[model samples]
Each structure stands twice: as structure tokens, then as C-alpha cells.
Target: MTLALVEPTVDLYGAWWEAHEEWGPGLHEDGFGLAAGDEVDSPAGFTAWVERVKAEDSTCRWIVEDGQVQGGIALRHQLNEATGHIGYGVRPSARGRGLATWALGEMLNEARALGIGRVLLVCVADNEGSLRTIERNGGVLEGIRGDARRYWIELPAAGESGVLTEKGADG
Candidate 1:
């Protein structure tokens, strides 16, 4: 499996749409808020949200396996004066193959380089796979949100680690 992060482009709109349409409803009540598309309602909202995330710093997608965009994860920077962190996620079907674990590790590797101190991730209460993925990535369960479980993974205070470099872009 090859894994690499890239920016969103028009070319991705189609696959993103298909992935979002299929996973949206089952993933959250705010289906429109979560899916990726061009409509001002569902996918548009995601685009706008992603843009905001970019403004804070940078955004990226984690593509895994055979150069296919099977799933993606974004590292959204938090600008709150009190806390500096990154947020991320992966596609639904890509859940079982340890992609999330790999993606989260890569995100944190990037975060550490970007001077981000903490990484936060949340999963729906029933998303057992996600919970396991997060735990595998060294996430510490913080608490529960309305219907989600929150976690925090602290990046090493300093020093470069061989974590992200081990996996080439072809995973």
C-alpha cells in the first residue's frame, strides 16, 4: 500500500462525490455538513470548511493503495490561542485495512514538523474500527462529545522520528 497526501483539485470532485454520497448518511446526522460535493448544501459546505482549514495553515488528502483515492484524511490546524492542534479523518470503506492508523501517524508527523503540539480526532460512538485505529496511532481517549468519542495524540516534543518516512507514497 502506498500513502501520500495532496491538495484537493477539480479532478477529485467526482470520486469525492461518490465517496461522500455513499458514506454521508450512514456516518452522521449532519450528512450535508460531512460529505464532499459542489452543492452549497452538502459537499459545498465541506469545501468551504476545508478552505477555512487551509486558511489556518494547510490541508491534505491521504491516498492509499494503487494510486487510487480510496480514502483521504485532512490535517486541519486549530488557531485557538490556548491550543494548537490538527484534526483528521479517512474514507469509510478504507477503514479496515489499517489506513486510518497509517494516515493518523502521517498527519502527526506533518504536525510535528509544522510545530503543532497536539492532534485531535473524533469518531462516532459506535465506530469501533475508528477507535481501534486511533488507539493504534497512540491517541489518548479524552472524552465523549454529543455522539462521538474524542481523542488526542501528542506529537513528540522534539526530534525527528522515522514513522512517516517508512511508508512510501505507494501504500
Candidate 2:
């Protein structure tokens, strides 16, 4: 079970779209609707979104596996001057492979080095795997906002030990 995380490129986006079309829809019943008629769905929106995220602060798009994309994860930084948080996510087929845990661990380490103080991850109430990923990364459940469960992992204050050391069971 070897895997690597690569940045999201145009080619990666295409692979993700194909995988989503094949295995994403109905995986969770009516949770995430599949792209209808090849219209503007989550993947398409995500492709454009990642580009926009790249324009600001920094955007990380990762492809899992030696050559297969599997899925992508990203850290979209918040730029509110007072808040330097990062938001992230992984693709469907790539979910249960610990890719999220690895990507997140890498992101947190990178964030710490970049002077970031915290990372935030949010998921729907029913997204158990995502919730577990965040928790394994030392994310503190910070209550819910509407339908989303917000979690936070405060980077070790300067000179403190980093919290996330072990990957989750899924990985």
C-alpha cells in the first residue's frame, strides 16, 4: 500500500472527474449529488475553486498514489489578518486510504514551519470518516455550525510539541 501526495493539476482534475462519475454518486445515498449532464458539480466547481484558492495566500492540491490521482486534498488559507487557518478535503475513492491523515499531517507540519498557528477542518454531521480523520490529527471538536461539524488543531505554540504524530486507522 504505497501512496504519495502530488499537487492538483489539469490532468489530475480530469482523473478525479472520471472517478467521481464512476464511484462517487450515491455512495452516501443522497448526501452528495452526482454531476448531472456534466454540468457544474462539485468536481467542476472544485477545479475552478482550487485555481482561485491558489491565487490567494496558498493552495495545496494533492494527488494520492504513485501515478493514480485517487483524489486530492487542499489547504485553503484564510486571510482575515487575525485568522490564519487552513481548510482541507479529500476525494471519495481516496477517502479510506489514510490519504487524508497523511495529507493533513503534512499540511500541519508545513503550516507550523510557515508560522501558521492553527488548522481547521469541517465536515457534515454524518461524515464519520472525515470526523475520524480530523480527530486522529488532533483536531478538537469545536461544536457545530448549522449542518457542519467544525474541528480545530492549534499548532503547537512555539517551542511546544506538535500534536499529530500517528495516522488514522483508515490510512
Candidate 3:
């Protein structure tokens, strides 16, 4: 399994539409912020949307396994001054497999590479799984926002121990 930037193509768009049909309407990662009803139903439109994401100030990537898109992670920089915000979701079929936790680790690596020192994550207060995933990735509870919980994960410098890295006893 690998985390890859989603490429706009007919195959991917078709698969997404199929998932939408089966799972009901929700965030589609590719065209984040756009209602599912507004999602382009054409390959060309989907490609154009992807180009927009590449041309935008944020970055989004997908969790791919065996040629299937299991989930996605998106990052927005400069939020709250010196912090990047993370948004992620896993497909229902891919739930309960630790994919979100692993993906969060990878996203933090991306953040470090881009000089991001701290990341903010907000999840529904009752989302136990999501809360655990954030905690596992080193997020510390900062506070709560309405029905959401806010957490912050400070990126570690190389050689510094943090929840982002796992080591065996021999290390």
C-alpha cells in the first residue's frame, strides 16, 4: 500500500462515482469543498478539477492499495499562523485496518519535508476511531470546538523520538 497524489483519470472518477452511488453523498477528496451534486460527471471536468488542486495553495493525496483508492489526506498551510490543518477520511470498506493511522504518519512526513512544524487536526468529538488515530500520531488535545475536538501534533526533528516513528526494542 502507498499514499499517492490522486491523478485525474476516467478510471478513478468512475470508481469514485460508483462509491458515491453505493455509500451516499459525502466528501470526495478530489473536489473537496464542492457538494457531491456539483461534482463534475465528466472525465475532462474531473481532470480539470485535479489541475485546480495542483494549482491551489493546498495539497491532497490518496491512500491507494492494489489499484484502489482507500482514502485521502489533505493539508492546508498557514492556518492559525505557523500551523497546517489536516483533513482525512477512509472509505467504509477500508475501515478498521489502521490505514488512517499509517496515512497520518505519512502525511506528517510530508509536512516535515515542507518545513511544517506543527499540524492541527479536528474531528467530531464522538469519533472515537478518529480521536485514537490522532492520538497515535502524537496529537495532544488543545481544546474543543463545538462538536469537534482540536488536537495539535508537533513535528519532530530527525533523531528525536516521537509518536510519528515506531521503533522495535532493539533500536
TM-score top scorer: 3
lDDT of 3 by residue, 73-153 (tens): 777765643223887777777778998898888878878878888888888889898899999998989988777888999
Stretch of 10 with least lDDT, candidate 2 = 29-38
lDDT of 2 by residue, 3-56 (tens): 766655555666555655655454331111222433325666766644554565
Q: Write the per-residue lDDT of candidate 1 for residues 1-171, one digit (tens) a residue.
A: 556665554445566566556656543422122334334235665567556434545556645455555566666566432222433455666657776677667777777888777777777779787789778888788888678787877776676463443346656
lDDT rank order: 3, 2, 1
| Full-model lDDT for every candidate | 0.60, 0.61, 0.70
TM-score of each: 0.65, 0.66, 0.79
Best of the two (1, 2) by lDDT: 2
Candidate 1 Cα misplacement greater than 4 A, ranges: 24-58, 62-64, 79-87, 160-171
Q: Which TM-score value belongs to model 1?
A: 0.65
Separately for all candidates shown, the number of backbone clashes (residues 3 or more apart, or on different chains) is: 7, 3, 0
Find the number of clashing residue pairs for candidate 3: 0
Would you give me the overall lDDT of model 2?
Answer: 0.61
